[model samples]
Target chain A: MHGMINKSIEDLVTIQFGADKWEAVKKKAGVTETAFVSNQSYPDAMTYGLVGAATEVLGLTADQVLYAFGEFWVTHTAFKGYGDMLMSAGRTIGEFLDYLPLFHTRVALIFPNLKPPRFECSDRHENGITLHYFSDRPGLSMVVVGMLNGISKLYKTPAVVTHTKFKDKGADHDEFLVNWGAADQK
Target chain B: MTDSAPMLDHGQFSKLFPFHFIVDADMRVIDTGSVLARVCPKIVPGALINDHFLLFRLASEPIKAFNRDFIARQENTLFVFKSTSTDLMLRCQVLILRDPERYLFLGSPWVRNPTELKALHLVLQDFALHDSTVDLLQLVQATSTSLHDAKQLSEKLEQRVADRTAELSMANAELSRVMRSKDDFLSAMSHELRTPLNAILGLSESLAEGVYGDMNTKQVKSINTIAESGHHLLALINDLLDIAKIGAGKMELELTKANVEDLCQASLRFVMEQAQKQKINLKLVMDNQSVMLTADERRLKQILVNLLSNAVKFTPNGGSVTLETKCDLESESLMFSVRDTGIGIATEDLKRLFSPFTQLDSKLSRQYAGTGLGLTLVMKLVELHGGSVAVESEIGKGSCFTVRIPCKGLDTLNQHNPSGTISLTEITPAETLPSNTPLILVADDNEINLMTVTDYLRANKLRVIQARDGLEAVKMVREHIPSLVLMDIQMPLMDGLDAIAHLRADDKHTDMPIIALTSRAMVGDRERCIAVGANDYLSKPVNMKQLVKTIRAHLPNDETL
Candidate 1:
C-alpha cells in the first residue's frame, strides 16, 4: 500500500461525507500522521486498518463501506492521471473488466509493491458474463460489488450484480455474475 | 482452502446433498441416496458414476486404485454434470471417505440466473431463488464500457495538443524568416551606400591634391570640407556593417601586441585640433611604464579614438579631458578611463547610455551631432575582448568611463581571419618607386570606381590599362600579359570570380598576381574571391593606400625594380 492510497481514501471520506467524518475515521484507524504523503509507500496493514476503521466510524456495514470506496477509486483515482491509461486499455465496461489482469500489471509500473489481484473473465455473452476473482488476501469481495457499480456509472451502462461464490463462504475464489442493460442516453 | 485439502472425511457431510452416490473400491455404484433414486427411478445400484454421468471437469473414472486423494491419478475438482434424463448440469462436490472406503458425491444444479433454470426440464419451485453468478456477470460488463469512453476522450485531447504545437512552431519559423530579412536589408544598404561614397571621397582627394589641375585656397578648403564630411558618413555606414557582423557572430580579429600608451597618444592626435578649437585641455595620465596586451592594434586604436573624440566633443571651453591607464597587478587587468569635465549625464540616462541609436538629447539642435552608435560599438568591442565597461557621473560635475579587460598578453586569444591572405596594416599604398612602374590591368563595371583607382595609380606613375568588364579585362591580360591584374568581383560581362578562375586555369598566366576588388563587404565574399583563384582580395570603397599596397605586395619584385 502507498500513502497515495490512504490520501485518496481520506479524500473520498471527506468529500462524500464531511471533514468531521474523515477526522473520526483517521482517528479510529490509529494513523498518527495528519496528512499522508502522495507518493510514499506505507505498510499494507495501515490501509486495511483504515478501511476497517472507516466502516466502524461511518456506522456502515463493511460491505457498504468497501463497496463505496471501490466505486470512489474509479471515479476519482482513475481521473487523477490514469484516465488516458484506462481509456487506452478499454472502450466499454465489459472490455475494461476483461482487461483487469493487464490493468493491474500496468498499475504495478506506478505502484511497484502493489499486491494486485488476478481477474479472469469467461462465458461472456451479449447480456452478462462470469468474472473470476483471485487474490492472496481474503474477505473483501463486497468491494468488488461497489467497483462494478462505479464502472457502470463511468460508462453510463447500468448493471445488476450477484455473487456466484464467496471466498468467505469457503469457496476457492470469489466469482460474480454481471448482467448489463443498454447504456444511458446521456 | 487449497493448502488444507485431503483429510479423509466421515464426520462432517451434507445429508441433504442432491444426487448422492457411493462408489465402492471396485468402481461400482453400490448404494444411492433417495433423491438420486427419485431422479433416476429405473437406475440400479450397480450403475457406475462414469457410465451414468459425464463430468464437465472430468468424467468419473473407474475407481481402480485411489492414492493421495487422487483416484487413478485423476480428481473431479468439483466437476459439473448433467443427468441422462434431464438437461440440467449439476455442480458436484466429491468426498472420498477413506475409513468406510466409500465415495460420496453431492450435486446441485448450476444456476447463472433464476430464470435460466426454468427451461432446464425442472420446475421453478424445485430449487432455491438465491444465485450470486448474475451479479458477478454485471461487474465485468460495466468496467469495459467506461474505459472505451475514456479512451475516446484522451485521444481527442492528444490530437488537440499536437495541432496546437504544430501551429506554434510554424509561427515561430515565420518570425525567424522575417528577422533574417530585416538583417539582410541592413547589410545590403551598408554596401550599396558605401560603393558610391568611395568614388565621391576618392575624387575629392584627387582634386584637392592637384591630380587633374591646380586649385586656389578657397577651392582647396571647400574640397577638404567635402572630403571630411564624406569620411564621417562612411564611418557611420561602416559601423552599421560592423554591428551586423557582430550580431551574426562573423566578426574576426587579427591580434598583435599593442602598446596602451601609444594607442592612447596616437588616438589623441585625431581629436587634438577639435579640442584646440573648443579650447578644451587634453591630458594623459599613466600609472606605469609598460601597458601592453595582445589585441588588433587598428581596432584598439579605433576604440581609443572613439572614446577620445567623444570626450573632446562633450567638454566645454576651458574644461579638461584626461586619459588614464592603470595596470592592476592584483587582478591582472588593464584599466583605461576617459574622464570629461563638460556636462555630465544625469543618473537616469546612465543606464541607457550605451544602448544602440539612443541619444538622451535626441533633438536635431543638440550640442553633439552623432548617429548615437559610438558607445554601443565600444561596449560590443569590449565584450568581444571578454571585458566590461562602466560609467560614473554626477550631473554638471564630470564623467569617468572605465574599461577593464583581462591582460592576456601575447600568449592566447589571437583571432584567425576567415578572409584572404594579406593583412590590412601591411598594405600602406606602396611608396612610388620610379623604375618605369609595373604594367597593371584594372577591371571594374562602375565607371566612377574605375576612374578613381586609375587616377590614384597614374599619380604614382604606374602604367595602367583599364577594362570596363571582366571579359575585356581577360582579353587585355592575355594580350598585354601585365605584371599584375586588379579584378573587380561584380562586373557586367563574366564576373571577376569567373574571370579569375579562367585566368588561373590557363597555362600561360598561372603565376600572374590577380587581386580581387569587391564593393560588397559581406562575410564570405572575400573567401569566395580567394577560393576562385585570386591571389588577394579587397573590399570597396577602396582605401587608395590599401589598394595600392595590395597590388604592390602581390606584384613580382622584378616588376617593381
Candidate 2:
C-alpha cells in the first residue's frame, strides 16, 4: 500500500481504537505484515498510497482527503470487526449493531461522515458475514474492496460491500451504503 | 468730521454691515475700527495679526470645532484665555455680536487680571494639600500615644506575672522545707519511743528465757507479762508510725509479680503457731493454682499475715480460721478471704474493722491485745495495689475479710522473690562472748539501756566502755579505739547522723565498723543506718543472737569464733 493509504488506515484506526487501542492494533497489524512500525516514526509509503486513493476519490488534495478517509476507514473497520466478533460468539447481529453505538458514539459524533457498517450473521450457515461502506470516488472502490476482502479473510467470514457518490453538502458531504448477509445463504 | 476719512469707528454707508477689523490681533490699537481699540488694549492698528489657529489647537476639540457661522451671526462672542509663556488654557467664553465685515461696534470690556486669578488658584490648591497633611499628622500623634499606652500596659502585665511566679516559688520552697522538718521530727520521735521500749522488751525476753537463771512460776508469769506488754506497746508504736508514713505518702510500693496462692499459704503458715496457741483450727482452701499478681511481694505478704493473724487472734478455742483464694479469670484478679469463726464483729463495729486504733469492743479489747493498725495497714497496702477489702460478719458467726487484687501475667513471676532470710547460725549471745575479749564501746543516752548492755557484756567476761551520748561516743572512739562501737541513733548534743558523719570523716575510725543500736524499727531505719556509714544496725531490745552475729560479721579474723 502507498504511504498515504497506510496513514489513512492508521488515522482511521486511531479514531476507531482510541489512542491505546490504536497502538495495539498498529502493533498487531505490523506483526502480521512483518513490518515493525514505531509510534514515533514518520509516515510510510502505505500511508501515502491510502491518502492518494482517498484524494482521487474525493477530488481533494492528499492532505484534506487523507484526514477524512483515515477517520472514516478506522471507525467503519472497528465497528465491523467488533460487530463480527460479537456475532460470531453466538450474538445476534442486530444486538451487536445495537451495542455498537455505545463504543462508536464518539466517532459518529466527531466524524459525521463515518457510518457504522451493517452486520449479518446466520445460524443455519457455517460461515458468518459482514458488510462495509465506502465512497464511490475514483480509487476508493479498489482500496475499499481490497480491505473488505482482507477483513473477510482475517475474520474467516464472507463480506459484501457497496458505496455511494460523494456530494458537496458542507458538513454532510461524503456518503456510502453497505449490506451484509451470510455467504452460504446469499 | 472725518467723514471723508471714512469714519473708521462707525459706518457711513447706506447699509450698515456689522464687520470690524484690526490689522494686528495682538494689540488693541486698530487702523480702521475705533471700538476694537477701546475694548482690547493689546490690539494695535499696524501690528501683524497673530494667527489664532495655534491658540485654537490648545483649546478643547469641542470648543475649537464650534461653528464659525453660528458665532458670526451671534449677538455676543467672547473668548477668554489665560496664558503663560509656554502654555495657554481657555478659562471662559462670551458671545460674538456680529459678522466681521460689519461696521465696528464696541461693548464694555469684561477682562479680569490673569496674575490675580493665578495667585488665587495657587492659594486654593495649597489649602487642599495642607488639609490632608494636617489629618495625617493628627493620625500619627494618636498612634504614638496609643503605642505608649500599650507599652505601659504590657509592662504592668509582665510585672504581675513575674510577681506571681516568684510568690508561687517561695510558697513551694517553704512547703518543701516544712515537709523535710516534719519527716525529721517523726523519725526522731520513733527512735525515742523505741529505745526505752527496746530495753524493756530485751530485759523481759532475757528474763523469760531464763538467761540469768530459772525463775518460779510467779516470776516467769510476771516476766512473760512484761515482755508481752512491751511487745504490744512496740507494735502499737510501729503501727501508728506506719499509718503516718502512708498518710504522708512516704511509703513506696516495690512491685513484683508474686504467686498469690504461695503468698497466701506462707502468710497462713506464719500465723499457724498463733492459731495453734489459741486452739483455733486454721485451714487454707485455695482453689486457684499458682495465680500470679503484680505487687510488692513483701507488702502483699504483710497484708495477708495481718489478716490471718487477726482472724486467729479473734477466734476462740476450737474456732476455725479459714484462708481461701479464688481467681476471676475474666477480670484477671485474685480474691483472698480470711474467715474466722470467733467473736464476730458487731454490725456497728464492722465499719471500724480497718480503722486505726480501733478494736472490736471494750469487752473484746480486754481479751485481745492489738495496736489496731494491722488491719489499717493491710487495707492501705491492698488499696495501693488497685484492690479493695470488704468484711462480712454476724454477731457470733465470725467475720470474713476478703481482699481482691488485680492479677499480673506469668512473665512477671521471676521478679517476685521473697526477702532472703538472714541466718542466725553465726551469731552468739553476749553470755557466750569469750573472756579477755577486746574492749567494746557501748554508747547510749539512756542509762538503763547502757547499764543493761554493759552488764550483759561484763557477765560475758568482756571489758566494756561506755559513752553517754553520740558526742561522747565519738570522743571515746578516738581515745579507746575499741573493738566495736554500739552507737545509739538519738542522743543529747549530737545524734547518730552527726556522730557517724564525723567518725567516717576521720581516718582512724573510718574503717572501725560501727554497729547502729537503735530502737527505731521503721522500714527505712536500717537503710538510713548504713547510709550514715554504720556497718550494720540492730533494733533496740535487739535479739542477743542477732546483735552478736552482727558484731561478729563486722569483726576482722573473727570468722572462726
Candidate 3:
C-alpha cells in the first residue's frame, strides 16, 4: 500500500473516474496505460474499479466506498455539489466541473453533507525505508496512509489532509475513510 | 230729487238705450234699460247675467284682453251690457259714487258684431274673384295675339326663303345654259374656221413643197411665205383655243415626271439653230446635273422653246441669249431663266410680254413674223404647272424671263419612265387584209393631199385609190370592193364622217378605216369622227411621218392584192 503499488491504484482510480465523466479526459491526461480491475460483483466497471481498489487496500465494501468517495469527490474536487451547481447554471455536473468555481458557489449550498477531512501523520520504518500514513479510520489506516504518501510524493506536500476522523474502527470503516480521502484529493 | 221728476220718463229712456242691459259682480241684473227689454223681450230686466263671459268672447280679443278697468276691479260691482237691437256688444263702467256702495255706470261705444265683420269679408272676397277673372281674360287675349303674330312672322320668313331659293335656282339655270351655249359656240367656231384653214395650209404646203410642179422663184417664195404664215396662224389659233379652254376650266394637264435638264437642252437646241441664223449667241448655263420635275413635259418644253426662240428672234447680231437654271431650296421650286442681251424691252412693253397678240415694238414686230401668242402660251403652260413667270428688263441692257416651277424630288420620277420601250414580242401584227383588197378611197378638196396620201400608200406597196370629194369618196367605195377608206372630213359635196356613216348604213364600208383627216384640233373631233363609224382620225396639215406610221399600223400588209 505504499510506494509504487499504492500509487498505481490511485492512478487507475483517477483515470477511471475522469474518463467516465469525459472519455477524452483520459486521453488528454495521458494515462492510456492505466486499466481498471475490480471485484466482479460490482455492477459498473469504472465505479467498481474506484471502489474495489480502495476497498482492497482499506478493507470496505463497494457501497461504503463509493458513497464516501462520492461525498469527498463533490466537496474538494472543484466540482463540489456539481449536480446542483449545474442545475443553477442550467448545465450538467461535468459541464459545471469544466466551468469550475465561476459556478461553484451557486451549488455550494447543495452539498452540505460533504465536509473536509481531518489529517494525521504516521511513520513506519522498514528495511531502512520509511513509510507514512495519514488517516481518520483504523480500518482504512494503511490505504489512506499509502495514498497520502503517494500524493505527498507527487505534490511534495507531506502535510496535506487526506481523511476525516471516524468514531468507529474496522476494515470497512477504514476503506470508507480511504475512499473519502481519494475523493478529497479529486 | 230734481232728476226724480224727470226720471219717470221710462219710455223716452227706452228709445235712447236701445238694447242695453248691465250685469253686477254676483250675476244679478243690477241695472237695466227699457230699450234692452224692448229689443229682446226674452231678456227680462233681471235676467241673471249667467253668461257674462260670452261678452268677452263676442268682443275683439284686444279689447277684452286689455280692458284695464275690468282687470283692476275684480270684486267691484262691474257693469256688463249688451245691445241686441243694434247687433252690438257693450260694456259700461260702474263707479261707486255718493256712499261708495251704490254703483253708477256710463255706457261706452259698441263693438262690431262678428256677423257684420263676416259680411264685409264676403264682399272683399267677391271683389278679389272679379279682379282675377279680368286678369285671366287679358292674359288670354295677349297670348292669342302673340301666337297670331308669330304665325304671321314665320309665314313671311318661309316666303322669303322660298323666293330666295327660287331666285338662286333660276340664276344657276341661266348660268349653266349660258356656259353650255358658250361651249357650243366655241366648238362650232373652231371646227368651221379650222376646216377652211386646213385647206389653205394643205394647198400651200403642197405648192411650197413643189408637189404640183416646179414654180418660178417669186411664185415659190410667195407660196413659202403663205405656208409659213398659215402655220404661224395655226399656232395662234391653237393658243387662243387653249386660253379659252383654260378660262372655262376645261383644260387639264397631263403631268409626268421629266428631266428638266434634258428638256431645256432639247428646247434650246431647237431654237438655238434659228438664233445662229440671226447671229445671236444662244448659250446655256446649266449648273444642276438633272432635276426631275412633275409637270406636263410637253407643255414645259413648249414654254422653254417659246421663250428661248423669242429671245433669239428679238436680239440683234452679236447679242447673247442665255438660258440658266437655279433651284429655290426653301420653296422646292426650279427657276428656269432665259436672259437675253437683246434689244431690251421698254418698261411699258414688259407688261405685254404674256398678253395675247400684244407685241412690244411695232417696228420690231414687223421685222419678226409671229402671232404674238408665244409668250402668252408660255405663261399659260407655266401656270398650268402651278408656277409663275416674270420678266426683268431695262430698255437696252436686255431682258430675263424667269419661270419658277414647283418640283418634286427625284424619287417621284420613277413613276414616269419615259423610255417606254416595248419588246418586239409584244407587237402583235394587225389583221390580214381581205382577198378582195379594200379600195381605200382618199378624198380631200386639195388634190395634193390626196396624191400625197395615195403616193404614200403606193410606196408602201398598197393599192390605194383616190377621190376628189366626199361624194367621189362615197362613189368610189360603192364602185369597188373597198374594205377600208380614208376620207377627208371637210370636203365638198359631202362631209367625210357623214359619208362614212351613209356608207356604213348601206352595209358596204361599215368597218372601213375611214380615217378622218381634218384640221379640227378641238377636243371632241376625233371622238365625233369615231362615233360616226370613222375607224380613226388624223389631224392636219397631216404629218407625213405620222400618216405613214398610222397607215402601216392599221394596214400591216397588202395581202388583199
Predicted complex 2: DockQ: 0.00
Higher-TM-score candidate among 1 and 3? Answer: 1
Model 1, B90-142: lDDT tens digits are: 67667777765876666656755333433453322232223223232222322
What lDDT does each candidate get? 0.69, 0.57, 0.55
Ranking by lDDT: 1, 2, 3
Runs in model 1 lying further than 4 Å from the true structure:
A1-186, B1-68, B71-184, B200-232, B363-365, B409-546, B549-561
- Candidate 3 stretches with Cα past 4 Å from truth are A1-186, B1-158, B348-352, B361-365, B410-540, B543-561
Best model per lDDT: 1
**Per-residue lDDT for B208 in model 3?**
59
Lowest summed lDDT window (length 10), candidate 3 chain B: B121-130
Model 2 lDDT, residue B447, Cα: 54
- Native contact recovery (fnat) for each candidate is 0.00, 0.00, 0.00
Cα shift from native, residue B148, model 1 (Å):
8.3
Give the i-RMS of model 3 in Å. 61.8
lDDT of 2 by residue, B1-87 (tens): 346765633443212211134322222324433333333334455543332212232345423233334434543544433332213
